[model samples]
Target: MKLTALLLSLSLTASAAIAQSDAASEARDAARDLEEAAVALQQAESSRNRIKALTQVVQSYEDGLAALREGLRRAVIRQQRLEAQLVQQEAEIARLIGVLQTLGNNNSPTLFLHPQGPTGTARAGMMLADVMPALNAEAAELRDALQEVRILRELQLGAADTLQSGLDGAQAARTALSKAISDRTDPPKRFIEDPVQTALLIAATETLEGFASGLTDMSPEPEGLAPLPDISHRRGKLDLPLEAEILLYPDETDASGVTRPGITLATRANTLVSSPVAATIRYRGPLLDLDNVMVLEPQPGLLFVFAGLGAVFGEVGEVIPTGAPLGLMGGNDPKIDAILSQSGEGSGQDRTETLYIEVRDGKTPVDPSEWFNINKDR
Candidate 1:
């Protein structure tokens, strides 16, 4: 009877343990369900918010289009100027060649081979000293003119390419703008609650250091954004965001005596800017003199800053896929023409759009040439 009672007690204990385990599992399941429901509710809210948040992006596209149109106009003017310059240079080069040929034929071989006497030799030497320098100078001029003509021809070809790109860029921007306006569900939300306040801070910060401080302190919360890829390993293999010419390299000092730790590309007007790697949009808007700037972080410490955009896309804290369209370079900025004129990257009067790209590791700037492919063929 005692043995029977003990078996009964053991059975009761086992049943109680099973019951507790089941209760704990149900509790965990309930918690998970609640978490999921909360996420769903947040998404619903975000979707509602995105509807009203598209104005800036649409305005950016319009700005980009205007810039592109301006760029195209400038490019045409530049092409005309280039053609005139090319014609003048070609004519000057031909004249220089003729003059050089005449000078070469002026008894130079005969004089060198047979000097009549000491007096003749001295006279010949004197003639050579005076005439040789002149000849050399003229030859140099011819060479320079020829080089200039070649460069002009290349610019002419490039001008055509730029015009085509400008047209395409404008179309792309318009389409994207329309889509962004219509699409309410997928638009990314601000990492922080107050984006205008963040934009103010970004605009107010004069230096990248200050910007970094503000951003790092913001406690950005990524909601429903995909995780970024490991971007530290891809070196010398990354393609440029645009098929544009690189005008400046890392650590190179510009005319202003400021050393840049990034690369500057001279792209066609209204050229579309894209991300080379999967990244999160850290900041978007003008910061200092750089108009319509956008910042992307591919990893925790690595950040890419692109400035001089005419229009911008993507929201802060949004995780974007590799090669995703960010925005279009502003073609309409008069400053672009000035920059191109200074850089000599334009065909004629119209300057190529300048895209200033700064890559940073933590708060420190790094050379983007080391990470990106700098091939001439793009």
Candidate 2:
């Protein structure tokens, strides 16, 4: 009355399909980049265009690190599921082992000599023939599960080294960027701010709105400087000034119950902040509690404002091209362990620093979300 074979056969009949996952494939590339991170960092530091080279290096390290963390997260979850499955199948596995052992023992005469003699023996042999495939299948599954767990364990163990390398490379790149910024010449200026006029504006303006409204008078564009191309045609398709995620949309009420007219972005620590388009720097400095603000006039009557920078680059009235470095975000870069821990929670954002962005068209605050395509980045 051994119904174990019947039960196991039933289980086999309900076998699920193999699932396809991106974790392994995407991470495989990240692993290769991690191995090369150090070399890349060294090369970047020595490059003539240190700022651009170092920026790419830092971003690449961040990408590789993110991929690695994602791989580990998925691998851990997969391993857990496999182990749980194996545990739950313990009784079935024991029965399978018993059946296997009985078949393996050539000296067990009772196996062939069923109680009803020749007729029973023939029937038992036929039943064994039918169940052999299912037993073999179950054993194969068990082997595969064990093998996968071992591979995942090895991946996790090796990850610590790769992650450390990425962290080191990222830090080195940041330092290089900082040094490069200090050495680089100031960008071309479309206008030269009168010291007295700038000082008076700063003293009189109570808010970012007031300052932005008076931007033309603070630093009027001179006649000789070439004007930047209008980006009106590219509305809703402009890149963000940095790799960031929108934390608060325009007009969203925050915990303080204050409604803001701009969007707040969450970005990684020490990451590069750039000008999204060719624009004139109306102003670049600390204002009120909004530290290190940079107001860019991309087109006549249109302005883009950025706030909360650790260090602002370029002088007021400078004309910067699209993608020019503007500033660096403030906050300590997250440790690898912290990144991995956060990855496991299914949100791979290490954005500890916040940057506020405001778009102004003809002196009125507009939603930045309408201009920047942040969804694709996320």
Candidate 3:
């Protein structure tokens, strides 16, 4: 009876061990699924951002077109008025010519010699001189009017041509924007998982296994496991001197597949924030009269700024870490606090008007959403 009891006890221990192992395996699988879901969410956010940027571009172009159309309308009215004045001046000149012809017939030398006395002839000569000056003045005024009309007509034609060109440009911009919006709104055909995330999961799985073993053995688990940052480093990690969030996403596209990044955080006066990745600083200065604007490189990539947390931080060029306090939230502009990214296809210069952010591996830009925790639900 004692031997049978020992065997049963051993079997029960074996089954318990199997159950624990199975649970660990299930947990690891769940972790993987979670990671994949995160990636998908990032991709969706990227698509949304692209569409937004294109919408802005389209709206801007449309505004310009409207302004041009208004100007064109005004030009047409002015041109017509000038044309009418020119016709009226020509008619007046014709009437003056007829008067001059009648006067010439009456005052001709032959008419003066045949019937007119000396006093009448002398009076006719004086009248002729007076009329000659008036005729010349009228002729000069008509010529001036015609010249003015010609100049105005040329200007009108040029303006019309310019309006047509502007319309063409606006239409092209709208078409491009429409195509971009469509692409972004469309569901992603391919889903990409972050390799770094996969590696992290694998490491976590191994660590969890060790922790479970320690618990089973009644031993202490290893201390000091790295904690995840509150803000997920889903966007490619940047080792920048300044800390801030991406405010806008790029949606506009140029010939090159690059996007422009913009910043909303108010940096210290003249703070030199470097690029998150290795690229040139395309622009560094005030944007729209607001001080502390800096754009960074890698064709189309991240923008960084060292915000002046009044009384705490000094001016620009001061390096800060990824989460270091650059400045407090409130700024003069109420809407400047939001973070965004740009992603369509253009350089930062091409997209300087809007904010943009990008995730890249070395030189190639990847969707930042994959690497950064962009709160998609919000």
Candidate 4:
């Protein structure tokens, strides 16, 4: 009976160990699943942000163009009215010239004496004298009106021409803005799928299963490992292509403060760099002002990666993955370095050149430091 008790005790100990192992495995699996779910959420949010930004830009261009067109229409109408007034003034001048000629013919001294008696001639002369000054004054007034109309017409025409020019410029601007908006709209065409989240999810799931399997193997009375909890049931848990870093932080004074978050990234080159959160190809082509731009969405917005020693990606809209090779660190401008050094001098910190990396949650710029694990020293 003592021998039997010893065997039972050994069996019990083994069973307890197996139970502990299974529990640990279960916790690990849960953690992995949570990480995956977080990644998916990030991707979804990134895509959504991109779409929102493109839409706003396109709408702004449309609204501006519409306003310009309306102004042009009003200008054209004013021009037409001025042109009509000019025509009327010219006709009145011609009528005045005809009246002056008729009076001159009737008042001639040879015709005045031959055609009529002394009394009639005297009366005609008085009438011509009285009317001549009035006719001359009236003619002069009509001529002045004609000149005024011409001046007014010229001014209106100039205004119309200016409006037309503005309209043409607006059209060009709208086309460019439209193209940019279109490039960002269709996701599949522009955005290369980054499978980082998906891969992490799969690996996490497999690791969990392996742990459970190991526990089962150690158990003497090996029933298959206890069933894992179902993670698939969780909502918002498996979206992919989530953003992993923010390169630029928003500024407090920008329009983003009202609608989305404002970003501090400047339009100047080398102000920031970013992980486009998708798989992309490097465009090693001709350099332009917009060089080092990665095309995150092939059809939509181009993510410009600035070039310095740190400004690595050179090509317009080249595709790149999250945390991929951006470029080496360097400062494009000396002033920025000096400013950094001055700020750090007070704290006895050495001035260092840093790369600007930005993650645009669509059009809204968010602080990338929030998402990326930049604390390598830690």
Candidate 5:
């Protein structure tokens, strides 16, 4: 009875939630996806492509966690809105409660009395027949509202367990993938780098543009390196390194008045950053302000610079196959309470970490939005 009363206190919130079809859909989808990843995590160790398998597992957990956050966000909004409605409807609710209390009194003298005689009683009976269906419908809705409260209560309890399981599974998968990257010696080396010149070049340059200008000339010195594939035909259609990704364009200025070149993407915690196309790693690791950068040369003059990675994989001058894991973005997944309490416009504004992507066709910077379809994907 105590539990029931508590749930009733939240009845309006749950009732509002019930009206929105997908209020809990994301939560359910997240649970199902995380559960599936748990099953796959067991087999990932023995799989032929452990890197890919484990990568998928981490991705699943991240995706599930993202969905779970959204579910909780919607729930918070629903409760707030419903609570406001309750304030507005307080008088009506009080009247209904009074009616209910009167109904509960079994010994009321006027319960079966009518003001008028035979014909009036007959008319009243007809009126009562008409009112019964609507009253029954209201009772049914109240019952459903109560049931929804129970479901929401159950979901809140389950979410704590879901969050813990997801965190463990995601961390385990990342550890396995990191090991796989470390143990592998199979990636075809494009050429041996004479880092002496590159290091000298880095020491001379203050900005990425200067280093890149020098790299354009120095990187071509390697002889007999196989030519990379032409992505000219695939100019507008390139796969993103992060899934369910959001992007910001160069034109959109932040609070401070400054413009940025290329496009920026927000990635999930330790999300697998992949090569969009077959390319050679011109340089990997940190340079300038960008932490743990990976620069790729798809063609002689075409360069793609990915920066702010937590970890970079593959060596300088190594051939990276398309969709190969480049590295991971730094950070741990959000906590269970954090996920529930997160609020803002939506997921776009909630991203805390950033991935800087700059593409240069020659000396001129290419807008990465050309390669990544933000409208279609985001």
Candidate 6:
């Protein structure tokens, strides 16, 4: 009886161990599935966002081209008018030259004809002196008019070149966007039918702060997640997401006297936005007045908030490498818009859109300028 009981206990213990191993395997597989689903969904969303931004870029280019063409037309017209006036001035100078030559040629003859009179000679000399200054003035005026015409012609040529460049850029952007859209693979089937998480995302659309705080509760914490690098030591060493100028600094008050806790960057519409550091996306959505905002966590207790996006990419729980493309700015850039609107404006002022970024050490907001490589001027 003792031998039989010992054998039975060994069998039970072996069976229990097997069951535990199987349970662990199943849990790991389930976690893998969840991660895969999340990644697939984020990829799809990123592709969609890219397509949208590219579309906007095409539209902006079209509008910009139209504006440029109109400006060129005006410039051409002005040049034509100036050329006509220039020609008239040239003819007037020619006539004056002939008159002066005739006077010079007749000077000796006039003196011979008026041999008995010194008064006539003195009067002729005075007249010649007076006419010389007027002639010189006319010649100077003609030269000035010619220079103006030349400048206008050059401006017209420059406008044509700029317009062509813009057209080419737009076409290239469109082709890339189209190819990307076409090559996109569909996300996993399970991600599409997830109504619970979908409902939470939809409901959390009221404000950015709310969405950011509630993101932790929307899904289970990811397993085997890697930690990001320490940002506190990387001040001034960090790369900016986009090439931009700092428009507003933290602690600075705006026209409304509202002090800001973050910095605002002046960037170009359609310029690439990117991750400033390696981090997981905590929140990405439109907020009350901030447009689209992306909340990223680079460390356990630090969060980076970016706003004023026309389009956003990435999903919550997705890890992003530093300098990865995030999205693009929206709207016809005021600077670019102005460039298109005004004649003689260079393309250099394309930096127009604004991005607002805030850094939070846990729940407290801190100045982002300390953590980022801020360009004071573009």
lDDT of each: 0.58, 0.76, 0.35, 0.35, 0.73, 0.59
lDDT of 2 by residue, 193-295 (tens): 7778888888999988898888754447474887788787888999888877788887888778968899888877877787888888888888888878988
Residue 224 in candidate 3 has what lDDT?
A: 39
Residue-wise C-alpha lDDT for candidate 4, range 1-378, written one tens digit per residue = 232333334334323322211222232333333334334333433454543333333233323322333333333343344445545444444554565567466866665562568887787678667655655554454455445445434533443343343334333433333343345533222223234532443344433223222222221221232322332242223211211222334343434442223222222212223333443432322123222323232112222222222334323223334433333233332232332223212321222332233333334444434443332232
Query: For model 2, which pairs clash?
Result: none
Where is model 2 more than 4 Å wrong at Cα? 1-25, 45-48, 102-124, 216-219, 374-378
Give the worst 10-residue stretch by lDDT in candidate 6.
Answer: 16-25
| Best of the two (2, 4) by lDDT | 2
User: Where is model 3 poorest over a 10-residue stretch in terms of lDDT?
Assistant: 334-343
Off by over 4 Å in 3: 1-71, 82-92, 102-107, 110-131, 151-161, 174-378
> Which candidate's TM-score is highest?
2
Candidates sorted on lDDT, descending = 2, 5, 6, 1, 3, 4
Model 4 poorest 10 in a row by lDDT: 235-244
TM-score of each: 0.50, 0.85, 0.26, 0.22, 0.84, 0.53
Question: What is the per-residue lDDT of model 5 for residues 1-378, given as tens digits with 9 covering 90 to 100?
Answer: 232343344455435534643556677888888889889999998999888887778778778777776776665565455445556545554655665477567687566456777677677667656655655554565566456555665676677888788888878888888899899885677788887888899899898888777888785455466677678888878877776354567655645664567667776667778888889999998898878888998877888888889998888888878888899888766776666556423665446567878888777787786776556443
Q: Residue 211 deviation, candidate 5, in Å? A: 1.6
lDDT of 3 by residue, 274-360 (tens): 234333222333333233333332322233332222212212222222332222222321111110111111112111222223333
Highest-lDDT candidate? 2
On TM-score, who's better, 1 or 5?
A: 5
Candidate 1 C-alpha lDDT tens digits along 1-378: 232333334334333322211222232333333334334333433454432233233333334333433443444344445445545445544555565577568876653543477778676568657655655554454455445445434543444334343334335434544465446355565354577768778667887667866765666766655566686689778888865667777777877887777888877566567788888888887677778888888888777888888878777777677766777787653343453343334342333688888877777777776678776344
Error of 6 at 281 (Å): 1.7
Higher-ranked by lDDT: 3 or 4: 3
All models, RMSD in angstroms: 30.7, 3.4, 33.8, 35.4, 5.4, 29.2
Q: After superposition, how far is residue 308 of candidate 2 from its true place, in Å?
A: 2.2
